[model samples]
Target chain A: MALLSIADALKSAIAEEMRRDPLVFCLGEDVDIPGGMGGAFTVTKGLGEEFGYERVLNTPISEIMLAGVCVGSAMMGMRPVADLQYGDFLFCMMDQLVNQAAKMCYMSGGKVHVPMVMRAPCGASNRGAQHAQSLEGFFTHVPGLKVICPSTAYDAKGLMKQAIRDDNPVLVFEHKLLYGGKRKEKDAISTIGEVPEEDYTIEFGKAAVRREGKDITIVANLLMNYKALEAAQILEQEGISCEVIDPRTLVPFDYETVVNSLKKTGRLMIVHEDNYNCGWGAQLGSWIAENQIFLLDAPIVRVATYDTPIPFSPVLENYVIPSKERIVEEARKLMKV
Target chain B: MSKLPEKERMLGMYRQMYLIRKYEERIYYLFLEGIMPGTIHQSTGQEACAVGMLYDLRKDDYMASTHRPAGHDLAKGVTLTSMMCEMFGKEDGCCRGKGGAMHTGDMEVGALVANAIVGGNMPISAGVALAFKMMKKDNVIVCFFGDGATNEGAFHESLNAAAIWKLPVIYVCENNLYSATTSIALTCNKPNPAADRAIAYDIPAEVVDGNDVLKVNEAATRAIARARTGEGPTVIELKTYRHGGHSRNDACQYRPKEEEKAWFDRDPVKNFRSYLLSQKLVAEEELQTIEKSIESDVDQAVEYAQNAPFPQIESALTDVYWEGK
Candidate 1:
C-alpha cells in the first residue's frame, strides 16, 4: 500500500490507465506543460514526461471544444479523460455534455458509446460565485451520464479507474478542499489515505460506512462527508451514537445501503454543500418518504447550503455552507422528532 | 476551369446526386400525404454539395453531419431503406427509430449520428481527426454545417484546435443563405465567413459554386488530399440555396421571389444533367435508365418503411447506457 493524496491518486490512476490501454489519453487546458502546474491543481503534473505529449495533450481555454473533442474521441473507441480548470466551467460546455455526449448513445440507438471521463474540481474555496460552486447537483440531474464524487485517495483512484473502463460518460466531481496538495486551502482537511498498489476498481452505487452507530444515519459526500464524521464523533461524546454514510456516487445512488442503515438507526439526516432547494438530498428524502417511510422512525431531514451564489468573504461563505455544527444540530433535531 | 473526372466517376456522382434529389422528392410527397411521421429539414437544392464532397471518401473515412442530413447520409452510403424506415419511426431504421429526421446516420458507414444543434459537429470532427492521427491512420473526417454555424464559438475553437494539432478534418460549410428565417447577411459580418475565419487559424479556405458538382468535387478533392497528407484542416464554403423551408410548414416568405427564381434557374441536378449530355460524358438513354432505377429504389424504400414495425414499447427503456454485448 502507498500513502497518496487525492491529486496524486487521480494522477496515478490516469497514468496507469494510459499504460494499460493505448486508446486512453488525457486533454484539457494546461494539462501538460514543460513546467506549468499539471492542470490547475497538479492532478496531471508530469504526465507528459512519462507518456509524451501525444497522450497528455494541452488544449486552449475552450471548454466547449474540450467536451466536444472528448465525445468525438470516445465515439471512435478512445477513452479520453478530459478536465476543466473548475467545475463551474462545465456550464460553458453544457451543449456538448448534455446535448451531444450524454444523448449520443440513446440517440444512436446504442450503436455508439462515449467511454469518456470528465474530471471537475468542485467545492467552495472563497473564489467567489463563478469559480467556487459544488455543481454535482446540476450534472446528477442529467440522464445518460454517471456522477461520482470521491472523498478519499483510495476511492478516488479506484472509482476513476472504474470510470475509465466503463463504456459510458462519467463525471468525477473532486472537492477542492479534499485535494491534498502543496498549495493548500485555508480550511483543507487531511484527506491522505493509503491506496493499494495493485490494480483494483470500486464499483459504483456502493456507499461506504465511515462510522458505525445506531442512533441516526447521516448521509453525505465529498467535503460534507468529513463534516458528518466530525459530527458523529462529537455526538458519540454526548452519548448519542450516529452512523455516517458516504454515498460516493449520486446518479447510481446506493439506496439499498442507505435504506439498510436507516432500518438499523430508525432515523436519517442528509447533508450536502449544494443548495437547499432541489439539492441531491431532496431526491433521497423524497425517495425515502415515498418508498422507505416504514423504516424511518422520524421525518427525513436535509442539511444543505443556502440557495445563493457562493460568496467571497470567509464569514459569508461559512454562513452559507454546511458545517459540522449544523450537521450535529440537524441530527439532534431529527432525534427529537 | 479544372478538368472533369473520368466518365465513370462523373456518372457515379450524377447518380448519387439524382438519388438524393429523387429520395427527397418522394419524402416530401410522403409527408404531404400524411404517410410519414415526424418532421424533415430537407436538402432539396444542395444535392451536389453533399455528393461532390462525399463521393470520393473511402468507407473508412468519417463524416459528421447536421440536422438536414439525408443528402449527406445518402452520399456517405447509408441505405435508402434504413433512412426511410427511420423517417417512418420503425424498428428497422438505421438508428432503430430513436433518431428521427434530425439525427439520421449509420456508424457502419463511418457517419457519426447527425447533430441537431447548430455547429455542434465541428469540434467533434476535430476529435475524430485527432483519433485517426493518434492511431497513425490516414483517414479524414468531413464535418458539414450551415453558414450560421460559423458564428458559434464552437466553430472558432474547433478550427483553432484542428489547425494547431494538424488534425485531418475538412469543414464543409453549405451556406444556404438563411439560418431558419434569418438571412446570412444579418447574422454574419463577412461575405465569406469560413474563408475569412479559416485564414486567422492559418488553414486554407475556399468558396465554390455549390450548384456546380464538378467545382465542388474539385475543391473537396484538394481539401481531402491535404488532410490525408497531415496538412491540418481546410474549410470550404459551398454557396447554395435550399429549395424548401428550414423545416416542415415553413413557406420561406422571408426570401424574395427574384432570389428564389435565380437560384432555381441554376438548379444543381438539372444543370448537372445538361453538363453530362453536352460533354457526351453520359448519353440521354443511360441517364434516363439511372433516373428510373433511382425512382424504383425510392419506391421500394417507401414500401418497406410503410410495412416496417414500430419498436416494442419496452425498447424505450433501453439504449440510454450501452449494455456491452
Candidate 2:
C-alpha cells in the first residue's frame, strides 16, 4: 500500500488498464501534451510518455467531437477514456452522450454497445458558474449511463479500472479539490489515502460508510462526503451520534446501505454540491418514500447547494454550497424531529 | 479517365442501385396505402449516391447513415426481409422494431442505427475510423448525411478532428437541395454546402453529379483509397434530389415546379438504366430480368413483414444496455 492521491491513483488505474488491454486509449484536449497539463488536473499526467501519443491521443477543444469519437470508437471495439475538461462542458456533448451513446445499444437492438469512460473534474474551486457545477445529478437521470464519483484515492483507482473495463458508458465524476496530485489547483484541498499497489476493482452501487452510529443517517458523495464526515464529528461532540455514508455511484445508488442504516436510526439526510431542484437527493428521497418509508422515523432532509449558479466570490459560493456547519445544522434539525 | 472496372462490378452496382430504387418505391407506396406505420424520409431519387458510395465497401467496413437511411442501409448489405420487417415493427426487424423508420440499421452489416439528429453521425464516423487506425486495420467508415447536416457544429468539429488525426472516414453528403421544408440556399450562402467547408479543415472535397452513378463511384473509390492508405478524411458532396416530400405528409410545395421537373428528368435510376442500355452493357431483356427479380423480392419481403409479429411488450424493457463480451 502507498499513500496515493486521487489524481495519481486514477493515472495508475489508466496505465494498468492500458497495459492490460490494447484496445483501451485516452483522448481529449490537452490530455497528454508534452509540456501541457495532462488533463485539466493531471489525471493523465505522464501517460503520454508511458503509452505513446497514439494511445494518449490529444484532441482539439471540440467536446462534442471528443465525446462522439469516444462513442464511435467504443461501439467498434475500442475502449476510449475521454477527459471532459470540466463537468459543465458535458452540455456541449449532450446530443452525442444522451441521444447517441446512451441509446446506441438499445436503438441497435443489442447489435452494438459503447464501452467508454468519460472523466470530468467538478466542484467549486472559485471557478465561475460554468466551470464549478456538480453535474453527476444530470447524468444519473440519463438511462444507460453509469455515474460514479470517487472521493478517495482508493475508490478513485479501483472504480476507474472498473469503469474502463465495464461494458457500458461510465461517467466518473471527480471533485477538483479531491485531486491531491503535484499539479494542485488553487484553493483545492487534499483527500489522499493509502491505495493498494496490486490490481483491484471496486464494484459500482456499493456505499462506503465513513462513520457508523445509531443516530440519524447522513449520505453524501464527492466533496460533500468529507463535509458530512466533518459534520458527523461536530455532531458527535454535541452527543448526537450520526452515521455518515458515501454513495460511490449515483446511478446504481447504494440504497441498501442507507436503508440498513436508516432502519437503525429511522432518520436520513442527503448532502451534495448540486442544487436542490430535481437533484439526486430528490430521487433518493422519493425512492425512500416508495420503498423505505417504514424505516424512517422523521422526514428526509437534504443539505445541498442553493438553487443558484455557483458564484465566483468565496463568500457567496461558500454560502450557496453546503458546508460542515450547514450539514450539522441540518442534521441537528432532523435529529430533533 | 479510369476505365469502368469489370462488367461484373458495373452490373453489381446497377443491381444495388435498382434494388434501392425499387425498395424505396415500395416503401413510399406502403406509407401512402397506410400499410407501414410511422413517417419516412424516403431516399427515392438518391439511389446512385447510396449504391456508388457503398458498392465496393467490404462487409467489415462501416457506413454510418442519417435519418434518411433506407437506401444506404440496403446498399450496405442490410437484408431486404429484415429492413421490411423493421418497417412493419416486427420482432425479427433490424432494430427489433424499436428504432422505427429513421433509425433502421444493422451493425452486423456495418451499418449502425441511423441518427435522427442532423449531422449526428459525422463525429461517430470519425471515431469508428479512429478505432480502425488504433486496431491497425485497413477498414474505413463511410458516413452518409444530408446538405443540412453540413451546417451543424458537429460537422465542423468532427471534420476538424478527422483532418488533424487523419482519421479514416469518407464523409458522403447526399446534397438533395432542401432540408425538410427549407432550401439549403436559405441556410447556407455557399454554392456547395459541405464541400466548401472541407477547405476549413484542410480535407479534400469534391462535388459530383449525384445522379451519375459512375461519377459518384469514382469519387468514392478515390476517397476510400485515401482513407485506407492513412491519407486522412475526404468530404464528397453528391448533388442529388429527393423524388418525394421530406416525409410522408409533406406536399413538397416548398420546391419550385421547374426545379422538381428538372430533377425528375435526371432521375438517378432512370438515367442509369438509359446509360446501361446506351453503353450496351446489358441487353434490354437482361436488365428487365434483374428488375423483375427485384420487384418480386420486394413483394415477398413485404409479405414476410406483414406476417411477422410485433415484439412482446416485455422486450421493450430489454436491450437498454448490451452486456456483450
TM-scores for all predictions: 0.99, 0.98
Clashes of 2: 0
Model number with the top lDDT: 1
lDDT of 1: 0.93
DockQ list for all candidates: 0.84, 0.83
Q: Which whole-number lDDT from 0 to 100 does residue B325 have in model 1?
A: 55
Candidate 1, A1-337: lDDT as tens digits: 9999999999999999999999999999999798998888899999999999999999999899999999998998999998897999999999999999989999988899899999999999989999888888888888899999999999999999999999999999999999997667889988899999999999999999999989999899999999999999988888889989999989799999998898899999999998899889999999999999999788888899999999999999999999999888888787788
For residues B1-325, what per-residue lDDT tens digits would candidate 2 score against the true structure? 2355667777888899889888988898898899889888899899999998888788989999988999999999999999999999999899999888889999888998999999899999989999999999999999998999988999999999999999999998899999898899999999999999998889999999999998998999999999999999999999999999998889999899999999999988889888888988889999999999999999999999999899999989988777774
lDDT, candidate 1, residue B191? 95
**In model 2, which regions exceed 4 Å deviation?**
B1-5
State each model's CA lDDT, in order: 0.93, 0.91
Error of 2 at A163 (Å): 0.1
Off by over 4 Å in 1: B1-5
Compared with the true structure, model 2 gives a TM-score of 0.98
